[model samples]
Target: MLRFILNNDDIGTALPPGMLLLDFIRYHQHLPGTKIGCNEGDCGACTVLIGELQNWAMHYRSFTSCLTPLGNVRGKHVVTIEGINLPGSLTAVQYAMQECAATQCGFCTPGFVMSLTGFCLSHQAPTLTNAIAAIDGNICRCTGYKSIERAAARVAEILQPRNGTTPAQYAAGAQILPDYFVQIPARLRTLHSTLESADDVKAQPIGGGTDLYVQQHDALGKKALRFLYDQPALKGIRQEGNKCILGGATTVSDLLASPLLQAYFPYLNNYLKKVSSTQIRNMATIAGNFINASPIGDFSIFFLALDATLVLSDGRKERELPLRHLFKGYKQLNKSGDEYITRIWFNLPSQHTLFNFEKVSKRTHLDIASVNTAISITMQYDIINDIRISAGGVGPVPQLLKETARFMTGKLLTESLIREASFLLQTEVTPISDARGTEDYKRLLLAQLFKAHFITLFPQLETAILIR
Candidate 1:
């Protein structure tokens, strides 16, 4: 038996494995406001706002119905487009969609509206840049994005009066009963594990099923996996002392939107915003990207470059390890089936230090990286005091160029040395060819990227002062 809140009503849905939320809403509940587009989660047509209560406080986020399994919504809230706005009275978002004339074919309206709705609840009168981040996960091929931004902006301009200030809360006392498919032993639930600390949590640990579903649905790889999601543990990003701890389930969308994150680690958002389509970023987890361990995972490139570390834990114990030490060989990680990534720790650079991240991708959206570079340098009076350089989409793991950094620090910031250093990076990496780019291209780019970093460093070197 699974329980959740839907549209301020307590309800239960006995979901079976492989039952998609988009299908369940359209078929089981007979609600049609949530549209379905690509079943693979590429299009945001099936977008919905899912709510979770953490420490008795409620927060909301958007999800693609196409990729989210119905089972994942258990003990949560499901806010469909129909649930938020009434038949006659339009929401600020819906009314704005009408006022902006953002719809044409009608296939993508519900998703845009739902995404705008989530954005409206979470944001105030948003700027175009913020609007781009919020609606990036939602694509409308017919209307382009101009009208959609207008509709989204209108949410802040709504003139109607409201009934007090309480946003609709998904009720907690939901009715639940037994189902035939799968059930935990009553003893397991009775034990030490809380509902939030659900054991045997495999597929649900994943945020957006883009990767998981692609792995399962493609028939070329790991198939038929049920889920991965976290209600509390895998959700927020905050700093603890020297390191910034990002939840394993933190989304690219979250990283790009966070003011605190940008103030400290601006390069991550600046580079990752160029990664996947806004829809994919909204759902893909930073942890999942690392866990997937592709040599080319964009975030890994910057993370490894930034000298970030990752935390791994089984239900029993937890350990923190250097992110560069993660790969054993090609495509293998320190994580085992019994263990999972719990958090990522990136050392926040001081105000005076300079950190940079860049990636060469096949396309601006939904393309794999050919080569990625991260560089951090502390300089004083035209001499390099300290430096760290890491590369991604280049080797088996995001490789730390320790020897290269060692050879360069305390050296004169000269043009000749920068050129020689670029050549040294080419020797450090081994490349593999795939659909995105060739091995030769990666090697060539790695060398060029090194040159770019040095150019940025040398000019600042003479003018900049080391923190005394």
Candidate 2:
């Protein structure tokens, strides 16, 4: 049985664990505020707030309901637009949208409203940048983004003093949501006690469902599913000695929120911004990205540059493999179906090490990369002591350029070296002409990206570079 609080009601059912939250809400629960557009996690029409207790406080984050499985929300509070709507008055988000005339056709309005409301309910500071980022997942054909931006700013003003107060408390007092939200934390605690775990045979493990649902939503119902997004054993980011350890089910959002990772890699947040939108990142797990084995997976390429390693397990036995070696070929991995990644860890960059990630796609944000690359280097007195470079979209799999890396090691930082390395990388990649770009284009792009790594880190070398 699956159990969770739907808005103000406690509900338990024996529905298939693989059933999507979007289907259950619209068809079974008759909640229509969450529109279905781009059934994949894109477009954000099905965005909704998922409230779960953390550290004895209710924390809220917006999720794309279309890709979220029911089992993933077990013993949690699921809030839709209807859940936040006041009986006789508009919530702060709704009021701001209306005041700014942010809606035209209104198809994407509910999602925008819920995302912004979640922003108000979040523990993040109420800065204008954070406020605008709240709706980065949504797409409106009306091109009324200016008005929507204004609405977001107004909502941030309303939430200026949101600190020292739980989002539920502030929302309840301000009538942004019904007072019942204040009691949800206790209710969830009670619900967690009554929940019983069920065992199912022939279950296909689904984490986040961001990618699985996009690829196989229609065929998932008949397949018994085990949702791993909330598994405690496979959640969290920690540091053991000099290595950063990430659990298999840890989402990109989890990495972004991790203090350990932030302290180790101060530019992590900026690097991840090129990966995906907030709605997708909130659901896409690190292990899933690596296991997906896509040549263009941003995280796969990112971690490969750091020389990350994965701990593989089948519940009883475990083994470690270098992340770069996990992929056997295009869309193929070295592990079997039953074997899953338990954790991923990499050494923290030393004081002499410099790391950078570069990505280019049709769209700069929230789109698949045409070409992406990352570099980690250690230098001593402007001489490269060691270097590793990884790239995607130019090979059969996310590849670590061992040849190029070896050539650059113990080499001086000069324009000639960078140009020679660029040419060296040309032979390492095997890009094909496709929708992203031609093979020749990708070849050129990788060269430019390689040069970018040096120019970005050492602008003084820009004048000396003649790679182009």
Candidate 3:
């Protein structure tokens, strides 16, 4: 049985764990405020705030209920639009939308409100950029976004006085969120203590369910799944000696929030912003992205450039494999079904090392890459001491560009060297024509992205001559 707090009510259901949260919210709980759109996680029309107790406080993040599984919400507070309403008036977020005239068709309004409410209940600064980013996953076709921008600005303005108070405290005090949020932590502690453990050996392991539900939604309902999203054993980011270790279930949003990653890669946010929307990042796990084996998976390519290692486990034993060797073919992995990734670790980039990730997609954000690449290089004065390059969407699996990296190593940093390396990169990839782009287009795009990595990292180098 899955036990959780849905809105203001407690829920304990025997429904299949893989059942869509959106379906449960609409059909089972009869909450029509969370509308369904795109079914996939693209449209944020089904967005809701998932508040989980962490470090003695409630940390709320917006999640697309359409891609979220019921098992993922166990022992958590699932807040819908209705949960934020006051007795006889709208919450501050709703009032902002109303005051700014942000609503038109009203279909996407709930999602916008939920996302904005999440921002108000978050630790992020009350800035227009952060406010707009909180609703990046939401799509509004009617207002052309100007009014929505105004509404988001208004919401941020309302939160300007939110000083150092906890999200729940500030939100409840300002009437941005209900006072019930203040009592959720204590309620969750009790709920978590009485929660039953699922120990079915025959169950399939699922992390996040952001991608799995989209590809195998119907089939998942029939299979027993072991939810790993909330498992205590597989959830943390810590530095051990020279390596930075990450729990396999760590979400993309976790990476964005990680101080360890930010310390090493100063521009980490700039690179991750292009990975996906705020909602998808909140639920898409690092291991899930690797195991999905999409050619253009953002994290897979990003980690590959770092030469990361994966620790695979089967309950009885553990084994380590280089991430580059994990993928054998298209949608194929080297490990067995029983073997699951439990931990991922990589070397921390030193001051001597420079890293950059580049991607070209049909859309700048919230879209899969047409061609993506990442490069990590250690420079000794003007000479390259060591280098690793990885690219995706130009091969059957995410390619480490071993041959290209080998050619670039020990070479001087110059436009001519980058031009030669670009040629080598093209030879290493076997791009195919697909919906994203043609084979020729992908090859050329990969070459440009390869040059982009050099240009971005080494701004002083006149590498513009290598673009062609």
Over the full model, what C-alpha lDDT does candidate 1 score relative to the true structure?
0.68
lDDT of 2 by residue, 105-153 (tens): 9999999999998888888888889988888899987999999999999
What would the TM-scores of all predictions be?
0.79, 0.98, 0.98
- For all candidates, the clash counts are 11, 0, 0
Model 3 per-residue lDDT at 318: 98
Residue pairs with backbone atoms closer than 3 Å in model 2 (clashes): none
**Candidate 1: residue 250 lDDT (0-100):** 82
Per-residue accuracy of model 3 over 1-468 as CA lDDT, tens digit each: 789999889899999988999999999889999998898899899999999989877899999999998989999999999899999888999999999999999999999999999999889999999999999999996855999999999999999998888878888999897788888999999898999987565689999988888889888877888888988778999999999999999999999999989999999999999988999999999999999999999989999999999999987899999999999999999999988889999999989999999988999988999999899999999999999998999889998988988987898888888888888778788999999999999988888788778778888764365444
> Which model scores highest in lDDT?
3
TM-score of candidate 2 against the unseen true structure: 0.98
lDDT of each: 0.68, 0.89, 0.91
